[model samples]
Target: MKTEEVMSYYAHTKIEFNDMFTHRVPATINGMVHHSSTGCCSFVFPLSGQGYFTFDNVRYKLMPGMVLHINNTADIDMKPIGSEGCHYAVIYYDVEETVIAHDPFVISIDDYTTCQRAVEQMMKAFTTPGNISRVQTKAYFMQFISEMLVAHQRSKHVDREDAMSEALAFMRQYYQSGLTVTEVAERFNIERRRFAHLFERYTGINPSNYLIELRIQHAKELMRATDETIASIAEKVGYDDPFYFSRIFKKYTGKAPTAYRQCL
Candidate 1:
């Protein structure tokens, strides 16, 4: 499927959310399936039956109440576990940047019972005939997004304490200045090697790489909203050399700055 087609699906899908839209798909599994367009990251909960979702060539079995996250850049392939097809509910939405900045990529909810209840409520709201107006549908979708975020945060595996707090504060303040790992470690009064290890342990990425991602993320916002030149945007994001900035931006976002701006 083309990107436009996928977007159209999101637009036309009978979804209901308070602040966002919710898409409920009932799918049958048999042969191999491929989603051509890069799908958005989403939550999938099995309401009945069983299936397996293959992502990036890894297959995960889906049982009742099982919530699976599919990456935005991945193509998902689903296969039924038994002869009977699986029935599932999928919810997709984009949270605020602040929320995403604080959350990890993958969050697993261990409390299946609570998740099942939430799914049932969402299904009830979705299937009720003439009960949801356009505004009500949109509101329910936003509510669903909020519920998913709450559940994911509650079940997050890693716990961050002193170091994580300091790291996040430091990033928010200095992300635009091209701060190095050594500088951050020095500020924390720790050895460079030890700081690297701790940062990775807490945040799941090395300090330097995280800073780079932060810068790129900010640069993307600038690109989308500003008419600034590519060189100027690079400088604002801490890169003085436009060539190197362009290369890194392409590597991160799969397009040159000009191309990205044009698309927007």
Candidate 2:
């Protein structure tokens, strides 16, 4: 699911902290253990060691820098992945199901040190003895949720920017190989329309137009440097039909290929 949807769900849903505890287990699981199904959602934050959780038969690896959320829907099994045991904090919270349904999800935290600090503070508050400490613990839990969601959003933004940069570089390098925008998007495993939208937002032009610009610019360079036929130049720049290439050339440069070459 998109980060926006998760943020939206949190924005509209009421979340109340129920309980929290740190669990330490041996390096092996003797048998399957069932997670609490008390109608509250659980968030698992690993502190040390490596393990994996099987939520209704679907497995998810767990370690530091990863946050896992399990709704009250499936039995969860935990097993260590290595010789070392696992230490993790599990926080349970009740969400307003009427506002938005919850699902199991695992998200990686970029600033994991800060997240660990927040978890430590929340646990401290939870263990303190007082009515005020209870309120403070709940407050810390909400702050933790808000910070995690915001941090994830920021991480995703940086990731998208980097991915778009890589995509642009790939397009510029392979533009003359009969490359299509759809093919480029598929190469990066991005959805077609979403890739176009992001490409346009990043480069101030859609990927298709950017590709056309690349081919047209290279064609102009070939015309200036080599005395090749328009058809040959068209093939060099990834166009099959010289007439079709000329039409697109004129559309972009305001002159036909032969006319543009004459001036060059």
Candidate 3:
């Protein structure tokens, strides 16, 4: 599912904390299956070691940076894959029947330190013997979820911006290599159309237009600095045919390459 959908689901759903516990499994343990038949959903947070959880036939790799939400009726199978035992915390909660999960999912978080602190507070409150501790436990659990969601959103935004910066750098480096929108997008493993859309959104111009503008800009620089022929200049800027390059140069600058160079 998309990140937006996951964030929306959590934002709209109502939940009440029931209880929480910590589990430690040996490294040699394998093929251990646990089913949640107690009519309560669970949020699993791994603190250390590595493992895998298979729920509803979907396998999720478990590590320090991931959190999983499983519905009450899921058949969860756990296996430790690290050299040491897996140490994790599980928070059980009840959601409104109308908002109950139809499919379990995993969330990847880059910042786990804050989550660890929240879970530790929840664990302390859960073990305390008082009505006030119960309330505190729920508050801490809610805060943890809220922080996780916000962090996910923030990290995603930063990632998109970083990817855009990298894409721009890639274009600048390869602009003279006869690069196409499709070729540049393929370098980043993005779909051609989506890549074009994102590039335009980030740069205020489509990839093809940006490439042309970039090549022309460099061509103008070369025209001023060198005595190369128009055809040679065209090839240097990634265009094979000088006549085609002249037409484009005219379109962008209202003058042919030779005329533009003479003015330069």
TM-score of each: 0.39, 0.58, 0.58
Query: 153-214 in candidate 3: lDDT tens per residue?
Result: 65555455565676788678666656678756654445689888888898889989999999
Runs off by more than 4 Å, candidate 2: 98-102, 159-264
TM-score of the candidate numbered 3?
Answer: 0.58
Model 3 residue runs over 4 Å out of place are 33-35, 98-101, 159-264
User: Candidate 1 residues 127-234, lDDT tens each?
Assistant: 666755544544555555446545544433324357566666766665555556775664444568987888898889888888889888889999888888998898
By summed lDDT, the worst window of 10 consecutive residues in model 1 runs over 96-105
- Tens-place lDDT per residue, model 2, 1-264, is 566777898887788999988888777578655565666788889888766778767877666656888886656678764446788888888876833334577765556677778888999999999999998998889888887876676555556677689778877765665667876665454678999998889889999998999999999999999999999898878787899999999999999998898887
Candidate 2 similarity to native, TM-score:
0.58
Question: Distance (Å) between predicted and true CA of 262, model 2?
Answer: 74
Judge candidate 2 against the unseen true structure and give its global Cα lDDT, from 0 to 1.
Answer: 0.78
